[model samples]
Target: MAIQKRVGIWIRVSTDMQVKDDSPEHHEQRARYYAQSHDWQVMEVYRLDAVSGKSVMQHPEAQRMLADIRSGHITGLVFSKLARLARSTKELLEFAEIFRQEGADLVSLSENIDTSSPAGRLFFTIISAMAEWEREEIAARVAASVPIRAKLGKSLGGQAPFGYQWSGKEFVVNTTEAPVRALMYQLFLQLQRKKSTAQELNRRGYRTRNGTQFTATTVSRLLRDSTAKGERRANYTQTTGNNKQWVLKPQSEWVIIPCESIISPELWEQCNGILDNQEAKRRPRGPKPVYLLSGFVKCSCGTTMYVYQSSKNYACKRCKTRISVADIDEIYQVYLKEYLSGINREDYLRQSDQQLQEKKQLLEVTVKERTKLAKRITELVDLRLDGSLTKERYTEQYTPLEERMQQLDVIIPELEAEIDVRNIQLISSDVVLTDAKTLYDEWGSMSLDQKRAIVEVITSKVEITKQDITITLAYATPPSSKSREKVSPRHGFMLAISITFAG
Candidate 1:
């Protein structure tokens, strides 16, 4: 009677091996042939291609082979060579122990090493050392390459930031994303005016490059970044120590290139000043009354307005304009009514129709532009195929155009959706008008801050001149109070009488 030997064959080839003639198929064939000669039944062939042998356990085929061995599906293992099994000494030892525990044998065909023989055991140890050396050399090579690539202004490794993309070797500025970056700068400025921290900014819908909600640390980092100030930075590293941690390195030590400035340096300085002031104010101090409009109110002198309360009235410190809080509240309500009255819904409908027409025209223009770009790409592809363009030149030119086409594809859909929404809003003007009326009816019951938000949405600016106050409504023409020949009532209040008494 002849004993049948069930054997699992393992084959591996690293990324570098794929470039050579010696492929995974060649190794598999060799292992199968050797197994047959030894009268071993080939149970399964586990081929792992383009995967490093250093981490053999992570390879899908290797894992399956291990499972088969453990389940007694195979009593022997065969490979082209020991290195084909794993490139790490620790991994080789672990596999050997597994085979030993399972009462199975491992055979390397080319090395003539078998776990069943004494001489083969010595050879396995030598092969394991070689594998460990190979892994260490590869690691050292990678460690050396990263800094050189970074110095060349290439991305080493990490997720790309907004307004920039990684094109295999270099970081290229995406023009479409530039506007979003500019918006962040604008938002930061608005936050500075409100004397709010990054936590507050995040809570108000600000997000990071990855569209994740922002944290206080992320905000602080953004504020301190010279990149927002139109400077490029490099070579920054995060460090960890005994519990306490903070961002290190002086500003001078950072590699900075002045790209197109997103935010002016002066504005950056002003934001820093505001942040410092807010931090100082947060410290232990006497309890102060919290005013919702504290940061938003501005004096006529262009200085930040403060709310000063006296026994008699609230006074504007710079303008010396003293008015009772109740009188101020009444005047605010009257101003709101006047602003709401000035919004002629019919005129807005006419303008919306005009805008809809303009959008249609714009869409036609965009379609034409897209057609031109597609034709250009077709021409470039033909030129490259016909030998008119070298591979390098074709790639350099084609990549940017391809990226632009992708961006256009994304933008065109967004524009079309926006136009659709605008058209719907314009057509349903009556519905919007009804909603606005309802909001106005309940305006008096709203909190002061809520009232201010409502008023700001409808009115852009309200200026009180010596004779009459001028109100500029958003998306509408400004109205002069002097033009009113009579003390006309607006929003259920006489605006002329309210302004006169407000003084």
Candidate 2:
């Protein structure tokens, strides 16, 4: 009997959203399909979900896979693409060397690279370098556009400051949020404490845009923001290092635009003056620890479970129904894999692509309209300059044209922003469908923060009980009309998986 070669599948999706949309089964099936074509047997799967490819050499999953390769547990490894394996050129080269020395084969489905052939080895090096270059080029282009967009008062992605909202590309005071934002300044002046202001706001049932309770940090930040005082600053901050810590850019680089004031500039100044004095004497607080499923976990008794006072378990205050952090995490990982594998993202992608095309068409029409209005205004100005028409007549014709031009200015930018957003969403959707197939294999290699981020995006709530657990997912559509509850026995516990999809 000819011995069938054993191969392991590698799946690594870079982003949390991608992991949410992708299914491990999809990737595994594709890899298995390839393996079957080559007369190979699939024995293992390695996943690095939501883990960065920048330097994956130190990751636990990567180490495990390497150990397996060296031990001959698997003579071959398969993955979606070259970049999915590793983005770092040096690391990719090192991986090639290790696989080569061990006489193991590496197969990249996307690039059609198989290390069993000499041509595949050459192609691997070339593709890795090209991939690294493309990433750098894209990043540089995005970085270059930020300052230009900021200076033009364009939407550079992200919501408007607390009190304001984008009204047709115009930064205007949000009616609902403005009052609360204005009160922050007034309350700060009266209380002289950010914490007290936050508490008062929460007590009054005022919540942030995301409907979260106000915190002292939120209060302090909103108070410091000059947007409420009519000056909106952009390109004033930059992120540093891998953790993306924000630091203020040089004052000279800041682009500040005047907008409608939520509060009087005088009030803003008074509040900030007190804040500035207090800040000098304030002690820095240590960073708070982030749990994997902090806010999403709930007990069957309808009470939220929290990890309190040196405990590794999340316990409800009402019923004291407790589950260890590790247990909930394991359940979440298993459920996510199963739920995602059954999900079909093709419909969603098609819908999103159609919407993106519609937005682009709208943007095109808007630009043309703006151009026509602009040309009409120039002609009106020319009539006034050449004295072909009386000043009164010119003003009559010019006023409405100029007004329409101003309206178009706002409309055009708003349309462009919408298109930009749509394009990004489509790109994300594409990434999700492409990368998620092997995410389960990569989950163990993810950092605590990465896992938490993924949980935050995909999971709505996780209900835990002695007998069962129900998990709700966000932005997912079930494959069947009446999807039955997936109940399975787990070490004397019955996990009743009730999947609910939310918009």
What's the CA RMSD for each of the models?
33.3, 26.9
**For model 2, the run of ten residues with the poorest summed lDDT:** 481-490
Which candidate number maximizes lDDT? 2
- RMSD to native, candidate 2: 26.9
- Candidate 1 residues lying further than 4 Å off, grouped into runs, are 1-297, 304-307, 376-434, 444-453, 459-503
Per-residue alpha-carbon lDDT of model 2 for 83-189, expressed as tens digits?
Answer: 99999977887787678668788987666565543335545456456655765788679879988998898998898988789988887888999999998888889
Where model 2 places Cα greater than 4 Å from the true spot, the runs are 1-296, 299-304, 307-313, 323-331, 441-503
List lDDT for all candidates, in order: 0.61, 0.76
Residue 71 Cα positional deviation in candidate 2, in Å, after optimal superposition: 51
Residue-wise lDDT of candidate 1 within 1-503, one digit each (tens)? Answer: 22698998887778865726565655665566556545679999887777887787866787898899999999888776778888887788778766766778887754556553333444445645665566568857875675566566766577655556667765556566555555555666685643255455466675667678755556555666666566657655433332226465565544555455566788778767766887788868777654433343333454444456543444456676433345444555665566457667766667877887898788778778878889999999999999999999999999998998876765554455445434444533433344555788887687866766555444444443222334444332322232342232332333343122110
